[model samples]
Target: MPQDDPWDAEASQHVARNPGRPKAGFYGAVPEDDEDGRHPSSDEDEEEEFEEIEVVPVRPKLSVAIGGFAALLAVAVALGAQTTGPDARLSYAIVLFGVQLLGLLAWTMALHPPAAGATAAIVALTALAADYLAVTGEPARFLPLIWVALGGFVAAMIGQFIRAEDRQRARDSWRSTLLIVLGAVAYAILLVLVRQPLGAQTILVCCTGAGLALLVARLTDAVFPKPRIAAQVPRGATGVVLGAMLGTLACAMLGSYLVLPFTPAKGAVLGLVAAVAANLIDLAVNFGEAGRRLAGEAPTFWLARHMQGPLGGLALTAAAAYALTHLYLS
Candidate 1:
């Protein structure tokens, strides 16, 4: 039988290199990380590997559990709100404060910005002050949370001057501070909401929507975190939109039974605001983490990183709840 193709050329192509002394390193070569012994691949194998590997999204069990926890907090918020008769805001305050501390921890750890300790301290103190103002001040005073946030901003700036040595850190510290401090103080809005005539009911309705939105989004992401918002951020657009719709539906149902100002239509509008705010903020945290990771920063603890997303979302929802309730009721 005749050979299909000649092997001589292929065999010739496999010829060994001529024996020679190895070339010396260039004088212009960079010295940084030289001792690490890893050389840049000309073939770009890592990028190919990244493209080939599938993203492992959040586990269904974990998503369900996290969502369940958010729902549980919703229950707690309702219970605390109802318990707000004489001298009982303390119970709700306790609950809100505990959550604020948790958010503080998660934000501080995930951000790891300069003057982190100072940022945490300022946020904690401001949260305490804001809660006190909300609890003791005249009913429907929206000024307290604002004032506390302003103070936090000032303190955060001072902290930057004192502790931010890196120019990059000086730029980033402000963002970290605002996220942590503002998030902590916004919880006071609920206290203000509780002071209204139908405030507790409002709390119930709003939290139901907000919590359900987060819950649904999480569970949805676990099952179908596809059409992902971004490759690095493992959340799906499907989950976010579906979560918002369902959350609005839940609030509308609650509002139908509750009262006049909180009619189903009104409640649905509020739910839309809260739900969108909640999901977006949660998604924002993931985007931030992705940014840091891609920039070669140290990875945050897995749990803390995940925990911050929900906590930030809920925190922002407080302001949304206050603004919307006041718009409809007042």
Candidate 2:
């Protein structure tokens, strides 16, 4: 074995003796950011690190419960269309109007826009007016829905300035108001659909498909969120594809109970179209949530936040139902 270098020991002793001296690499000594290894919130130090995570993490129990709620909502609308006999349109309008109110409430809370109270009131009253006009006036005329939407939009924008917190924010409220107004108007489309021949059956099948799709998608997300659609969004690609297929199958099964001009094949078609439309709208909600999160805004309560997607989906599906009935049955 070789003997130790006495010069190395002497050098070490010299370095230890002159602790104030800087090392070869720099002009002065460098101190660690955190001697205890704590990291800053920004993770800027060598000792700190953080990876991007989902803005909205998935919760299994919550997802399942939301799924069930979406299904019940669909079922309620279905019953309104099917059970009222000669007054089916009126019944459907009433039921759907209630659903629209719920949606507006949730949406207003989620956005919390300037003049939010007045915005909600304007949208709700617009919905009421549209519903009354649809049910009382000419059943075949569709003009009332348009006029109500336009008038409601103008009122919503003007109402923004009534008690403005900030002029810019008040201006921003207009877009949100437009969404609620359009959604309420969309519900009135159902009244027209119900008044059409065989329209009740169309609502049953399409609503079944939409509701079941949302339910199945939510439950599936609870169980398996693998192949995640986006890192920021907690939805699963598996759930979306499987939900749509199951919704189609369910609609097909429902076709047998339908009267003339509908078959299993036609029901499947309606389910496909309606389910796609509903799921797309639902997915858009998640995307909006992602955007808001990225903008550093905190979300509202989980239950209230999650529900508007499904309700919005069902609201728009009414339009799809009308179109499909005309295509397949007319």
Candidate 3:
């Protein structure tokens, strides 16, 4: 004997009553309405369901705890660097990198997930150990690492303010791009200017080079927009790198001709490193964003977003600047 279809009875009943409507089961069927012309369940049910969902509040206490730990670590590194002799340039570089890393971590944790704050703290300590193993020297000779540390915190706060304003204003794409470029230029200038007692000529050369690089990058972005086929690569990455290379080369040649203390070869080297670092930073940011969006609320997601993206970029840029000032200067 063959089994009967279970939907047959209901289908026949509805089909006979509503001849114009299609048969109902899974698809192409409208819900049956009563004499009042309303479904059995109304929108009120959905509203109540939505109302029951709870919103999690952000906990500032966690951010504060993590930031405090980072501050202590930074103080320890700074004190260690100060106690070291003047010849330990490598030690100074490591300390500078640590301070920069801590400052960036603090900023990211304060803004992003509170739990990821611990991850940022751990990374800072790990970096310190890695740097110690990688390079050994007496201490920084030219620039003060302490200023770079302080500058990190200041930059973070300023960045947070700008970011909030941008979101509130709903800035368009072009305006957003312009703001980011300008911010980068401002940061570069700040880094250079923070080195007190710098000669007028030194300041002029450094600022000009940094500013020109940024301008060239911005112009290049306008002229040669990323191609559709280049979707695999982050937008503006190629243009920014190319512009930084060209601008840095131009500045290096000019600096050499102007009889700047650093050799032309050193200038070219610094420009090349800066270009590479900029590209890497862009890639890291793109990758981090994509990872976060795909992974949702996972701890790994927050870790990548907070630690690997912005903080990584800032560290590379700081390292490049330190090398340029300390290694090249007479």
Best by lDDT: 2
lDDT of 1 by residue, 110-132 (tens): 97857777778878899999999
Cα error, residue 165 of model 1, in Å, equals 3.0
Q: Give TM per candidate.
A: 0.80, 0.80, 0.37
What range of 10 consecutive residues in model 3 has the weakest lDDT sum? 177-186
lDDT of 2: 0.82
Candidate 1: C-alpha RMSD to true structure equals: 10.6
Q: List the residue pairs that clash in candidate 3.
A: 87-138, 87-139, 88-137, 88-138, 88-139, 89-139
**Candidate 2 colliding pairs:** none
Q: Model 2: runs farther than 4 Å from truth?
A: 1-51, 54-56, 88-91, 163-166
Q: Residues 14-121, candidate 2, lDDT per residue (tens digit)?
A: 878887635445766553335566433335643345544645688898889878988999999888877756555666677878888888887887777677788889
Tens-place lDDT digits, model 3, residues 1-330: 666866688888987888775435659787677689886577777777776522222233432332233234323432443344435545554555644554444334422522233334433443443344334323313233333334433333333345554434332332322222222222232223232233223433443343344444434444554541133322354456665677468557756864556567756665566545644554555454545444573333344243333333434444455556655664
- 1 or 3, which is superior by TM-score? 1
Candidate 1 achieves a global lDDT of 0.80
